[model samples]
Target: MSTPLEANQVEAIQGYDAEKRYKYLVKEVVANREIWILTDEHGCVMLNTDYEDCVPVWPNKEFAESWATGEWEDCKAESISLNKWHSRWTHGLEDDELAVVIFPNQDEDGLVVYPDELDFELKQQARKQNQR
Candidate 1:
């Protein structure tokens, strides 16, 4: 079951293309100061793609929870603060050569971005938010 707000959000972004979703993710994560990912007893979930392995991220828990079905049914939404993401996650993902899938939709479509590229965008978003 989803909250009314969550349902509204789902509806609102239903028509957003991948690029728009990616931009929404950057803005939301910066404003929220956290990023959401799915995790289970083992570890954070990773997606295997033809080109590279990707860590799927969302702007909020509700979005992350939307992906926690099927093979990821046991997964739980986890939050990583923006500071931790910058201090640790970006470097760790870069070392592992993992890309990031930003805010995938129900059809499993999202923008696949390199760790450095995403990190840069997140920082830029954060800076813009600070200037406001």
Candidate 2:
């Protein structure tokens, strides 16, 4: 397992722009071999964007927990193993026509991407990591 992120590291990552944050998500999720999301009693949280319904994902629990405020106060941070994400989530999300919001910050700003796109990138990153 990966070491837990320090407070400063979390703070710094939260301050990053959307692109940088998305990149961080790719790297951290690959290293940790899991993807973080918010879930309440009902099910996984979903955000409605201008164009599509997106499921917000984070690189770690700390980042996911940060979003559990206000309306989402009851939400809990949950992890989906990278293997499960690739094997199940990718196909399920695509079938449901849902996108993914990668590492949203306080302002709820993030990069919306297709499930297949993210799955491909994560797979590529995992391959590169394995090679090193």
Candidate 3:
């Protein structure tokens, strides 16, 4: 487990570069047993196992907005950090589920991905459904 940061220390991170802040957030989520982050229908950050069960919990509006739009290239978001992006929305999670962070594509509307071994399969299914 990582050392818990005091409120002031956490506040200090606000001044950190996006890369540093992003890393710290991921570290916290992993240490807390891998809570996953997802986006709800309205593009707010959420937590839980399935997309349907997710509820908005994270607090960073700017980060959430960028992620909702997939404008992550400038954010230097790698797969791992991107998965942990939920931490950018808030400092804590509502539950512990596998430390994953899921993002919805602009085309996916109400759905999000879990990004595991089945990620490709899931994406294919989503595409097929969209083709309907």
Measured by lDDT, the strongest candidate is 2
Report the alpha-carbon TM-score of model 1 versus the true structure.
0.93
lDDT, candidate 3, at 5: 52
Model 3 lDDT per residue over 21-78, tens place: 4444434444442333334444334445544444321123233334444433333211
Clashes of each: 0, 0, 5
- Give the per-residue Cα lDDT of candidate 1 at 56: 95
Candidate 2 residue pairs in clash (backbone atoms < 3 Å): none
TM-score of 2: 0.96
Tell me the TM-score of model 3.
0.28
The lowest-lDDT stretch of 10 consecutive residues in candidate 2 is: 1-10
RMSD of each: 2.7, 0.9, 15.4
- Best candidate according to TM-score: 2
Off by over 4 Å in 1: 1-4
The lowest-lDDT stretch of 10 consecutive residues in candidate 1 is 1-10
lDDT of 1 by residue, 3-114 (tens): 2246776768756888999998898888888898999998999987799999999887888888899888999999999899999999999999899998887874798999
For model 3, state the Cα shift of residue 70 in Å.
23
Point out the higher-scoring one by TM-score: 2 or 3. Answer: 2
Q: What is the TM-score of each candidate against the true structure?
A: 0.93, 0.96, 0.28
What is the per-residue lDDT of model 2 for residues 76-131, given as tens digits with 9 covering 90 to 100?
A: 99999999999999999999999999999897489999999999999889899999
